[model samples]
Target: MNGKQKQSYKYDKHKQRLFIIPARITSNVNNDILVIDRIYDDDDGRVVVLDREGQVKWTYQGNPQVNSGDKLFNPTDIVITSVGHVIVSDVNNHALHVLSGEGDVLTCKVMEDQGIIFPMSLDIDTKGQLWVGCHSGDDQRKDAKLHVIKMSF
Candidate 1:
């Protein structure tokens, strides 16, 4: 096993498994902490919020505020908009989920269509345009690509 070492880790003795532990991101909103639950269910992943000292603040399940065609699947990356909206990158679904700062689904936008496979990361530029990175699902050899979406005021 030749790779970089992890910061912290945990072991499940009963289950006979070892896991790399993750540190928490300090929320700029209120100094609370945030963590991502990488895998859940038979579909995808989700995000969980915690206090500064590691306490639950909030969490978003697969269900967005509005249920429609194709929900979030395996959310892998997240970002906060200038207007205080939660932008979650749903890898399996090849799209983005826009939510209120409090974790309420405001809207869902299909970031790509043609060959967009799995988006892994997201960010909002100073101009408010959305940027995305595509992983293996895209199969482009680049491992990732950049895209800009027109921002809606």
Candidate 2:
């Protein structure tokens, strides 16, 4: 293969087949691959965690209680913290969903109070803080902003 050519496939070892539609991906310190699978024509999106050997560890499809009205609609980005927590930016939901290493929903923070409209991307800094990039809710697109949130866990 040429240097510019790359190959990609979606296979789940446990299922013995290809099943993942990866939209965004990130890795933890332990090299665990965290993938966000965007499901078309459905309200349910998924977060799949896989080991280095392509073995499925755990999967999250959003918490119904926390995501009651909105759901995990259109997860744009994902970031894993040093401590193993998975944070996802839910653009349509206008919130950040925090999940445990085991795929349980720990907390969901609606950024409305913080002036965050459509959170599109996020990253964890060396100091373990979360920097979120958001677009304005206003149709004029004159109020985009970036928010820095101090993470405790």
Among all candidates shown, the one with the greatest TM-score? 2
| Candidate 1 residue runs with Cα over 4 Å from true position | 1-26, 40-43, 64-72, 114-116, 136-143
All candidates: TM-score: 0.67, 0.81
lDDT values of the candidates?
A: 0.61, 0.78
Question: Candidate 2 lDDT, tens digit per residue, 1-153?
Answer: 567834344666545644436778888878888888877744457788888777888887665655776455567789988888899887777888899888888898888777887898998888888999997767787878889999986
Clashing pairs in 1: 44-74, 45-74
RMSD of each: 6.6, 3.0
- Candidate 1 C-alpha lDDT tens digits along 1-153: 668863332323344323122322325466544455654353445667655444455677555432235554566777776777777777776777777777777887665565656777777788888888778763557566776776674
Error of 2 at 53 (Å): 1.8
